[model samples]
Target: MSDRGRVPGQDYGVKMIPYEDLLKHEPLREFPEIDERTPATLLFTSGTTGPPKGGYHTHRGLVLHTLSTALAVKNPPVNASQDDVAMVLVPMYHVHAWGWPWSTMLNGHRKIVYPGRFDWGHILRVIHEEGVTFSAGVPTILYNLLMHPDSPKYDLSRLKFIVGGAALPEGLLKATQARGMTVISGYGLTETAPVLTIAYLRPEHRDLPAERRNEIYLRTGINIPLVQLRVVDEQDRDVPRDGKTIGEIVVRSPWLFREYIGDPEKTRNAWRNGWFHTGDAAVWYPDGYVKIADRLKDVIKSGGEWIPSLRLEDLISTHPGVNLVAVVGVPHEKWGERPVAIIVPKPGYEGRLTENDIKNHLMQFVEKGEIPKWWIPDKVIFVKELPLTSTGKIDKKVLRDQYKDALPK
Candidate 1:
């Protein structure tokens, strides 16, 4: 170890060896024969919904997931090839960085660049300097990249982004497309080796109108190869594919976790009815794509009707003055829970972004029959920043707890 790399040995109760001294020892000749079904990794959830739960995966599961991910990227909208340079923006600890380390190597990608930390300006430089052509991360990462003041300094036309970890807001998707970068959406959970779906375009979709194509590109997407997915009602019956009826998403894939490590109760609840319950509310399209409405816990219950907060957040994000936004259900007397939006305004619009501005913005969409009138947020709170989880996703649980009483009776 270098002096700079050394830590206090006494505190850890272990002796530290310098790099030169460690190198003097002979390396092991024989390695253990590991089984494909052997326990591979134990990853924890991002804790966005609640307490983080452990997801235990196997070597076989991870390997199969890597192959599926490679296949998804190589197909349709992404068209990834060995000639394309790859950069994984997601942190390695987060769902094993969405399995890019294994997939990139398996696909024979020419070069792989790892941006050390997520400084937007620094990331922009890495993308431009290293000629990075492909990458994957959550929507928040993409938003930060585009919002940085120095982003225009780099030519990001060659970039391709695979957004996951959260729903891809339509406004953010359009902004990314405006930069000439191809942006696609994906959906998964930490328990499923995290790559269940990719919003790839089919051969027949080539000549579709731009508006319709954009709509499909931003959906949660169809099931990836070897994965069985369905949106089910409370009785575990499949939901109608009318695009208006919402149901819970359930899935079965070769790479899903076996259990929630040491928590059989949670494990049982997650694996109900012989399928892994995703607890995500979504609507299935006639074309077989799945569009997430909101998490089951995050849906706002107002006047005996459910309002998807993700829809509200997505529309609110389109507002020119809004930077980051989160919609949560707050306690209300007339309506059990009412929608409240917490917003981080753009640099020039601080203190100017008001409840009326957001309500008026959403009202336009409602009038266009794009969203329900009740889906509009009742209250809007301006803040400098929204709380983020350790994995860089919006910490809605914190927001819900902090502002549970924001609405009056």
Candidate 2:
């Protein structure tokens, strides 16, 4: 097998194995000897908080994750037949891609591996030629495809479904659905072997009103079987399930990773009481669905109150003039930290928005007391585009490093 690294356009420096060689290799006689506690794979955390940590998963854990995710998304004997072909768009190095490759193989599907880097033209061509029925990608990748000037040049009707994550934006989902494609949003982290919950349209919900169904589509989704989830407070106590009470999300699953590699102390802290703590703050709906609000570390703490950065960013992105936006915390003496929004305006719309316009739009929320007056961003930085990570999420660490020192004393 040839081992290569760092292709020109790829971000994560993934190692690619030729499809011909992969087909010729003999299957393993037995699964690797790994206990429930042994490390099967090491996935690095997103590191939006401080530094990336490597979370270790076991062979059994990964298998559980795969089966549960497949069941949640309704990939059954019909849609995902043994003869079905799958073209993976997410890089193999990412948890979404890494976990899916094994899951597809386990289900006996034919896999067409894309070489390093995502070429939109090449991807469309391969799907039609290979008769690819299922695909997995991040929302950013899908957005690029749906907006590509040549998208109509390729026949994509054969695609049955697309599993999107790694920062799924609402507008991206709507755009894909408009093209007669089914888009499923799933939530997970590298630490969990990455498939904890999936947004599936329940059989009963199919007959519901169009507007009601659309509301369900906006939620992150319900938990898959065998995974126990709860929204908790700082004291590790469960929060009310009124669908409005916000708390940190914690999970206990058969597929949970053991701990962060080489950091037992952190591992012990995160896995306290035998439950893996997800630092993401979230809320649960009355119907047992969970919606992630923001990362605890990323939440802006202003004037002894918490502001959900993810919610704010989502709201800002809905504006037609805004292309992309990231909300970051800027140091403050009185409030401890305040929010600053970095915006990339849509083409030809730059310099059209003023600070007053933003405040005016947010004034409606201020009146409802959903947000305080002080929570408004101190300043807005306009840019051509936001820097993204290998997985396509905003690279907040890079932004922090660039602006952390520039914060006012």
Candidate 3:
């Protein structure tokens, strides 16, 4: 029997078994012949609402996902070279890391694994020592590196490209680009092998003003070839592409996983009518780019309308004085569910900000009616830092656990 042990700093444990012992005892004498429909790997959905469910992807599905990603990033348009060494900073268990490992290997690029928890000093050291040319990580990881005191100590000149996902903070993208790094914002989910679209810089945008180019890069780019993406309303009808119509993003892709393992009911609901339901609410730009507003479940319904918490959090995070922000719905008898802004102020800016300052800052949106007055946060709670998940996204589940009880009755 295999024994399990936990990796340092990891919440979960892994089975301990030597490769030699495995070969000796349980080695496959003859490879099992499996069809394209056979299950290859099981990916657990990000448990934002409930317990994580295992989503199964077939070998055929994964192969397509890997090749398509390679073609999208390494083709003539982008031309990501095989000489480039990729520094993967995300957790190995994450679909982004696991899926890209095969893609990078297939493309003949050198893979430099971090092999441990993310530490800014260690990541910088690895980047400098390994002469890493490409890096892929979530926005939070990039934010930490860009803001770290020792960030300037290392020579990051060899870095050529960076891909941000799993929550792309707009301010972080701007900061990365200002530092002369070529940053691209992408979007995907665990069910899609975590890669659906990347911010493909259009040829025309290259010559545009820096501010304009940056704005385009902040939105998710057009769908990769062979993927059909649409924003639909409650009745599954398509929403407009005028850049203001927000709807749930549903995707149909050759690379999408077949079903959730052992959960037929959820699988049925998630794959209703053969489309993988992302549960993420988004808007499609006139330029064909998509911007995710918030998770449908996370969208705060106040005064009979939806207030996208993700968009609000992104806007709040842009403030120079704010280090992190999480907007959550609290019990509000008046508006049904009112927003509460939980903020982590920048190092020197603590105790200098008041609720009115935040309110005044968000007043521009209120004036435009892009955000309703009732949707404005009812309270602002200052905190040291936002709790983050293993994947670097804000851990909203933890935030709810900590503050749900304190919400006004």
Best candidate, TM-score: 1
Task: State which candidate, 2 or 3, has the greater lDDT.
Answer: 3
lDDT of 2 by residue, 272-304 (tens): 776788888888887788878787878888878
Record all residue pairs in model 2 with backbone atoms less than 3 Å apart, i.e. clashing. none
Clashes of each: 2, 0, 0
Alpha carbon deviation, residue 188, candidate 2 (Å): 1.0
Top-scoring candidate (lDDT): 1
After TM-score superposition, what is the CA distance of residue 155 in candidate 3 from its true location, in Å? 4.0
TM-score, one value per model: 0.92, 0.81, 0.87
Model 2 residue 339 distance off true place after TM-score fit, in angstroms: 1.9
Model 2, residue 269: distance off in Å is: 1.3
Worst 10 residues of 3 by lDDT: 3-12
lDDT of 1 by residue, 65-145 (tens): 998888888876789899889998888888889999999998898999998887899999999989999998988899899
Cα RMSD for candidates in order: 5.8, 6.5, 5.3
As for model 2, its CA RMSD to the true structure in angstroms is 6.5
Residue pairs with colliding backbones in model 1 are 1-18, 1-19
